[model samples]
Every structure is written in structure tokens, then in C-alpha cells.
Target: MAPVNEAARPALKAGTRDAHERRIDRAVALIERAIAQGEEPPELGRLAEAAAFSPFHFHRVYRAMTGETTGQTVARLRLLQGLRLLASERRSVTDAALAVGYQTPQAFTRALRQSLGTAPSELRAEPERLWREIDRLAQPPQPEQGEDAPPLRVEVVSIDPFQVVALRVEGGYEAKHAGYERLFGWAGAHGLLDRLQGLYGVAVDDRRDVAEPQCRFDCMLALGEGVDPTGLPGLRLTRLGGGRYARIRHVGAFDGLEAATDALLARWLPASGERLGDALLYHDYLDDPDQVPQALLRTDVYLPLQC
Candidate 1:
């Protein structure tokens, strides 16, 4: 994969997304940098302040983007630091542990074992395996599906500019049904209902990072030519500046969306000559979950690509 180009056009188009998306991306990048430098991940309160989110909400947002709780991500990063110290710097076992904030060498070894299924001593003899172990353990298990699941199809396509009437709700990952319920209710009460052109959703945060109540999700519907959402309760006008997107289809139930997204970034994007950046992640819902069975619902995941 080519290196990330900070000045890419996709990064420029990212300005079209809600500002909060950019803030969250910045906060995550900060935490990632801290960990890479062998420093402690910032405290929740401090991170929240930096991200311009409340402590309670930022935790959930962090999980949504990284697919791991803050503590889990930090632990993994620290262990990685320990591996670098031991292998690359040739630090002693005890010193290496201390370098990454572990109180004792034994504690570090235990964590390494738990996370990688390999003890420190074993890895010391074969240091190259540390990264391999990290990759193996990070992969989420793919959901089981029979031949009924649609074959994965991918395309690089340009999206046209469009506007959405959306509402942000905080809840657990699978519980987003209630948010959409509220959105539809408000839309109906305002007599703004129309023949659906396209159903849409923006994942504002991840559930795995916090309590279900704290996870933030955005659900929206495309604005029809004559539809006006002005003064509508709980609905805000969001404009997505369309650009080239690497659109991939998820053909199974919603439960597998996280894993599918993970696979797209970790397994495919790198080799596809693309780099992930500040561009807003958007979800295009093609089928209504209410009308269609869970197994048949289709959602397209879009990641902005540099033109």
C-alpha cells in the first residue's frame, strides 16, 4: 500500500461532514500517537475535553471508530511497546516491562501471554512473531452464513452531493432501531413523509466502547426534491459532499457490520492502494430492516477514497 497523502482531495472533501466527525478523528489520532510513543493514553476526562465531547459520550465514540474499548486499545498498544523494547532496543525483560508502564516484568509477561497467547520468553526468541500474533488476535470472527448470503462485490464509484435530514441518538450498537423509530416518528408527525428515495445512517460512535446508552448513532433519510425539513424537531440538515468512495456491500444481518467494516480497513484498503483519513464514514441502507428479514438486509459501507 502507498503511504498516506495528507493533502489528498478526499481529505479536502471531508470538510463536508459534520465537524464532530473531524473532532473524533483528531482525538483518536492523538491517542494513537501517544501509544506509539510509549506514553500513557490520556485520561477519559482529558480526552473528552480534547475531542470536545463529554466523558460519557467520547468513550462510546472512541469504541465505534477503533472497534475496541479505550482500555483494550491501550493495553494492546502498551504490549506492542514492550515487544519493541525487548526486541528492537534489546532491553532486559524487566526493563522492557517498565518501559511500557507495566509495574513489573511478570505483569507484562502475563499480559503478553493473555493478549498474544505467547509468553514473553517465547516471543523474545522469535521477535518477528509479535506482530503476527497481534494481527491474528485482532481479527473479529466472521459471522456464519450459508449460501444465501450475497457474494461480496466492490466498486469504486463517485457519489453525487446530497442532503439529509438526520437525528443523532445515543444508544447501544444493536439498539439503533429505537433511534430510527424516533426519527421516523418525528418525520411522520411533521407530515414530511414521502416515497423513500434512499434510507441513510451515519455511525457516530461504536457500541463496543461504552454502555449501550452512551453509544451515539445518526439515522437519516435523503431529502426529496420538494421535501423541506426546516423547523422539524430532532432533525438537522446534513450535507455530504460526495466524492469517490470505495463502496462495499454487506449482505447479511446487522450483527456482522462491525466485523465486515474491520475487514475492509485491515484486510482490503491497504492492498488496494488507498489510505484512510478524515473523510466521514457513511452508511447507505438499501433495504428497510422492518420490512425485510434480518438475513436479507443490505447495507453499503462507504469509505472516502483519494481521487
Candidate 2:
């Protein structure tokens, strides 16, 4: 699924942004709940009401925040539900298709091809492989604001909620150095750079589905409550709720981050008997590319986990 190309929205005030995000979470939860019911799910108007937005506004707001249209999320959820049913062998293909709101097995198979890159029967026959190819499509590592673990070594740890002064950017990962420089300049000018304890990155959208030009990320520096930039231009302060997280280090370039994330999600997660946590994955920058070689640059990928 291609990322929707939407115009930039005005910057959000901290309180308003928090409320908006929470509402989005609520709206998504409702959608997921309906998907789990294995029924047609709720109507868009009802979903909007639950999210406290008009149907028209809700559609736009949802895409703005999550980098996906409401229809895409709903479709992905239904497809995943169908895939799970097939994997568990709990339902025949046709039954699974109907449960996910497909009117016919043919329609279901066609959707599976479009989204998962494989037919329903193919996915059922090779669940793990199919899962590897399509997992990011469902929920790529996301940002809930947290950072560094050891390379390839998986560790489980708890994170206390923290705050950061962040600027959202769009474009290539390395091209984001300009964005980082702007952030550093702001912090330096305010005398906050030296006091900063950690530098972090939030993968706001998955590149697999988002065009490079449209990818959104947050360049953040750890800022305590005492250092508020309430009215700072191009900067916002947000809190990422903390919990248990599965942390792993990705050595080498950011380009390979996807495979590293996949290792954790597709390989390590199921074997650990742990479930994916609600928060998005965060990157803790360990070395500066300007100072160190790209091959040696390191980042810690943190995957929030259900404890």
C-alpha cells in the first residue's frame, strides 16, 4: 500500500497533540476490536462518532497522524485476521474470507495478493515466510518515543516515561542530517545541547509503505521537564508512555534497519513467548556518522513489549 500524499498539517500544541493522538489510538482500537469480532466491522460514521469526529474530518485526521487512510487500516486488520485464521487452521479459506467481510473467496484472494503479495492458500502453506514478507505492511516499527540496546543482542528492559524536544522531518534517513543540525542549533543556542543526555530518532512511518519523500520521522533530544520549549518554532515536546520493551542493536547503516527489525519481530518475538507492545519502536543513536564511519555507525532498536 502506498502512503497517502497529504498536505502538511499545522503544528499541534502539546496538549492538543496529546489529545489527538489518544483519540487516534482510541479510533484504531475500535477498528481492531471490530476486526477481532470477525464481522463486517462498524460503519465509518459510527467509528467517527466513537472517535468524536465527523466522518469526513475523521478520515483526514486519521491519515495525517498514522500515515495510513482509515480504509487501509481496516483492510489490513481484516486481512491479518483472515491470515491468522488460516495459520491456525481454525477455518477453511472460504470461511476465513467471509469472517473478514469478504463476499467471496476470490475477492479475498485478490486482496491477499495486493496486500500480502501472496494468495490466501500460499500464505497458509508457508505461514512463517509469508509473515516475514508482510509483517511490516501490518504495523512497521513505529514511534512511541523511547532509545540504545546492544547490536543483534536481544534484551528485555523496562522504560520510564520520558520527554524530548523534537522536530518532525520528511525525507531520506541520511538526508535528515540537515534536520538534526537544525535541532542541534536550536538546543545549542538555548544552552540545552550540552545538558542533553541522549539523542534519539522516532520512525514515524514505515518506509516499506511510505515513499522516501513522504517518510516522517522525529529527531529528538532528551529533555527534562525543567527545559520546556513551549513556543519554540518547529519543535514539540511529547511523552512516550513507558513499559517493558524488547531492545536490540542494529549495527551498520540505517538502510538495513528493516531487516534488523524483522529479525526481532519475525524471528525473536514468537520464540520468546512475548507479544508486541503498543508503543512504536525507537532508535537510540550511539555514534555520529560525521565522526564515525557509516559501516560502524550503530543504533539500538527498541520494541515495546507486553510485560
Which candidate number maximizes lDDT?
Answer: 2
Worst 10 residues of 2 by lDDT: 1-10
Best by TM-score: 1
Give lDDT tens digits, candidate 1, residues 1-307: 1112232233223333345446666776676678666577788787777876566445644554455666876676677667777776557989888877887889998998786777888887775686676565444223233235544455666676677778787776455777677767777876767645677787776555457787778888775545566664666877653666767788878767766665555444433555443456778888887789989999888776656
CA RMSD for every model? 9.7, 13.9
TM-score of each: 0.59, 0.53
On the 0 to 100 scale, the lDDT of residue 264 in model 1 is 56
Off by over 4 Å in 2: 1-152
Task: Please give the clash total of every predicted structure, in order.
Answer: 2, 1
Query: What TM-score does model 1 achieve against the real structure?
Result: 0.59
Candidate 2 residues 1-307, lDDT tens each? 0112222223243455456557677888888888777666678788777877656345544554565667678888888777777776768989888877888989889998887677877777886876764565568234321124333467777777788778888988665787788888888888887787677888776676579999888888886767767545778887653777777788898887766765565445534555555575788888988898989989888777665
